[model samples]
Target: MKAAALLFIICVHLVSGGSHSLQYFYTGVTRGINFPEFTDVGLVDGEQFVYYDSNTRRYVPKVDWIKNNIEPEYWTRVTQIAQGHEANFKANVGIAMQRFNQSGGIHTFQSMYGCEWDDETGATDGYEQYGYDGADFISLDLKSTSYVAPVPQAVITKQKKDGVAAEFMKNYLTQICVDWLKKYVQYGKSSLERKVPPQVSLLQTDPSSPVVCHATGFYPDKVMISWQKDGQDLHEDVDVGETLSNHDGTFQKRAELKVTPVERKKNQFTCLVEHKSGDPIHMILTEEKIRTNSAGNNLPVIIAGLVVAALVLIAVVVMVVKRRSGIHTAHDET
Candidate 1:
């Protein structure tokens, strides 16, 4: 029992001594002072001692383990690097915003980490800032900020605004041109023989006088005027005028056709404007003097009218027959 008591006291002494060693080293290292070896050489002041294990690549904490683990210099370096990167990122975003605002293009600014100020509306915005924990790092606030600016002065002051708008407009015009060139020019060239198609106006007009056809829309230069009669293409009977481009870059086309009075009365003529895209659109004109033939064209309506007339006639005949029979029966009873 005495031996066991002696052993227990020794164990307690060793534990206490080990704890004291760790505490002294943790305190000194955190104060930027050198750590001392765990050996019993009386605590030396101002002497740098390496307490790191070279084989294990681990440092022994001389101060509180949590407090001394992160060096102040390490955090300082990290802060400096982050600030520099943030500056560059903000500068690029600012330049892009300035360009888009001046040119009337769409561009919006958003904060990935810090607060952003809207120069237009004077609003402040904040986004999530990223941070590093002891073991891992993560990004916050993944959403885009909501400050949009008008086109900047730099974009407007440059002579290229018209050119840029034109370039943007070109996409729409190019599509039209490609379709037109394919249908009219390409298809025309592929035909066995080139012929100037006639222009017929289907709208009501006097055959003895010239009928005027006007064109209006975005593309004026790409329009062709022609006339057709009884589904056959005509050439000499139609006169097409030059297409004129307007100040807004749109076009206007006109054509005139003179037909015989008999042709107008027959309602056999149609006016066709062939677009560059090979899509032919038309307008029909009829003369007021022409009597419309409803004979075979209104078969269902004629049948319905005949059926109603027959039903009314049958009702009248039945009423007369019943009246006569009632008189004969009454005379027989008297």
Candidate 2:
């Protein structure tokens, strides 16, 4: 269950597309506590399809396509490889603990490797990087084809390894990984290529709050949100937040623009949203157009109230007709 939750967080770091990707993440913890000492996950196009852990000691498929389409031997080979990586990561974490002169606190060593392919342009890219205690430690520089260690603590380990691993990584990322990505994409093409458009809203809390342009429920995870003033684009004072995943596999993003009423009155303000699912959207920021969370400003409640009033009016009309028909029948009888 934790592995499934991690997939959503990993979406923010992926190379998104019309393209496809194959990524593997491994982590080793200093102390197991309630969690596994070592864990591994594999994702294609931001969706987790396979998972492994020190406790499980097995490579297991998370989706139907793998069980239906992939051979059993693939899991065996992957499990063996992950076991080897688990041992190395554990030892590396201990060594790091010693080097840092820490005796008992929890620490982590993490590694991520992946390849991305642009189906539209036939372009490709690959990456391999490692982190220690949640900060950059070492990475294979694809451009220089050498390892980079950002801090002094990692320099010793960086000096021990040569260019052999980098060369291997280059080959795997460019050729082997991309081939696997294409296959996985084919296996799930029905879902991998489908598009769902975004639902966009412009929101404000009060007269002094920043105006927010929120877009949610978009698929493919690629979008552009920006602010425009009059006929020109406003590049400054706009805070663009990270793209986040929804529980149902869609994506959302927010861009906030801080503007004074004087500035808003002098120029036309607009939020422009672009996504692959549909045509671009331009929402002009007028005071009357922005949805608010102030007292008595809930849109849903307002709409519901209108619906209730209409229903009450219809019920009254029906009752009046019934009463009038009964009176007419009595008078005719008399």
Candidate 3:
């Protein structure tokens, strides 16, 4: 029993100290730091204007709303503001890394300053977060800002001595979040409840094969994509994909089903999409339906082709008649 107890204590000691050794092993080599060089901020009424610098290459006008509505003068001012913010953020990050003695491989640092006011609740909240190497090292909320535990003891000690936590909260609230809110409120009170329905498409690499249903351009992010057979949900042979963000701040996802020949013949398979938008969208699966939709989309092209052919035939007939009439006139004159 005494030997067992000694073994258990030794295990505990190793487990406790082993984690620190592992962390040091992983971050032993010093790597240069690279911070984000751009800023993106926006406001929304019924319309949203998400402004970012075009030079930053992070902003792509994939949504028609941004492409059509962004004013040139507004873009100019936003670009300048983004540049300034980037400079200030990088400078602060540099100072923090130096303070932490970060001479190690690939450490990431992040800072977010946000403010929101709710008209219904009459609550105004501001938040700030500082993360190092993807862990929340310090945080600032509406009430207080403090260093989180589980960080390096050296870091915690330095932060406490320098009063960094309190200063960060003050500067972020007064200098950053407040200023952003003042500008954002002017755009209007556009709640995030607005839902933009996804644009869905069904794809099959081969005829009479497995079907893939793709959904894109949805907003607010909560959505359900399913494969159904004869009004019943399917489990087996169904592969549900993850929802990912689009460049324009929208979301997209896909679901695939490997269907049997018998199910394909019955024409009862469908891809159902559920979103915050009212009713579910149904995309029927069958070769006949695919051909019908294809034909309907091609109707305009078919009509245009027929019209062009008829015009060419008429032109040729007119030219032949004119040539014959000229030959007859020449023959009579001769």
Off by over 4 Å in 2: 1-18, 30-37, 53-63, 76-80, 203-209, 261-267, 286-334
Residues 1-334, candidate 2: write the lDDT tens digits.
Answer: 1221112122225566567777776767776356577777666776667888999899898877767788888788777766766676677777777777878677766667778998989999987666666666667678887778787776765565435545655667788778878888889787767789988888777789888898877887788999999968998989986665454556677899999999999999999999988899999998877898773566454334333322111100000001111001000000
lDDT of 2 at 208: 92
Q: Between candidates 1 and 2, which one is better according to lDDT?
A: 2
Cα deviation at 20, candidate 3, in Å, is 42
Query: Residue 165 in model 3: shift from native, Å?
Result: 5.4
Query: Deviation in angstroms for 245 in model 1?
Result: 2.0
- Candidate 3 global Cα RMSD: 25.9
Leading candidate by TM-score: 2
Give the better candidate number (2 or 3) by TM-score. Answer: 2
Candidate 1 to native Cα RMSD, angstroms: 45.3
For candidate 2, give the lDDT of residue 239: 97
Q: List the residue pairs that clash in candidate 3.
A: none
Give candidates' CA RMSD values in order: 45.3, 21.6, 25.9
Candidate 2 — what's its lDDT?
0.67
Question: lDDT order of candidates, best first?
Answer: 2, 3, 1
RMSD of candidate 2 to the truth, in angstroms, is 21.6
